[model samples]
Target: MLFCDPSMLPCYRSVQCIGYLSVKIHRFMLYTFTFIYSLGV
Candidate 1:
């Protein structure tokens, strides 16, 4: 169960957005590393 008061809504939304972007950046880094490794082999 998640509950956010009106005053806290903006802060909560920003946290969620930051978390989503971090996950995406992590996946991109993983792909980049693998591609470089394959080229090096």
Candidate 2:
């Protein structure tokens, strides 16, 4: 079993953080598109 080193934790964490941020951004874009489409009616 490979134990994660403290130094590597930040790098791993940053990648996870970016993934989470991108998910949020993706949702925001979808939400905005839906909202705009609804306004067209």
Candidate 3:
């Protein structure tokens, strides 16, 4: 079994948040690009 140190919880949470935010940003950029492409601009 693997053990997680209590002191590392914050670091883990921050990493999770960064991952989530990056995914959201990527999705937003993809949507915007598609919209602009559809406009032929």
Model 1 Cα lDDT, one tens digit per residue, 1-41: 03333555687867766777788899999999999999999
**Alpha carbon lDDT of residue 1, candidate 1?**
9
Return the number of clashes found in candidate 2.
0
Number of backbone-clashing residue pairs for each candidate, in the order shown: 0, 0, 0
Candidate 2 at residue 10, lDDT?
83
TM-score against truth, every candidate: 0.71, 0.71, 0.73
Q: Could you give candidate 2's per-residue lDDT for residues 1-41 as a string of tens digits? A: 13334566787867767777788899999999999999997
**For candidate 2, what is the TM-score?**
0.71
Off by over 4 Å in 2: 1-8
Query: Judged by lDDT against the true structure, how good is candidate 1?
Result: 0.75
RMSD of each: 5.2, 6.2, 6.4
Residue 25 lDDT, candidate 3, scale 0-100 = 90
lDDT of each: 0.75, 0.75, 0.74
Off by over 4 Å in 1: 1-8
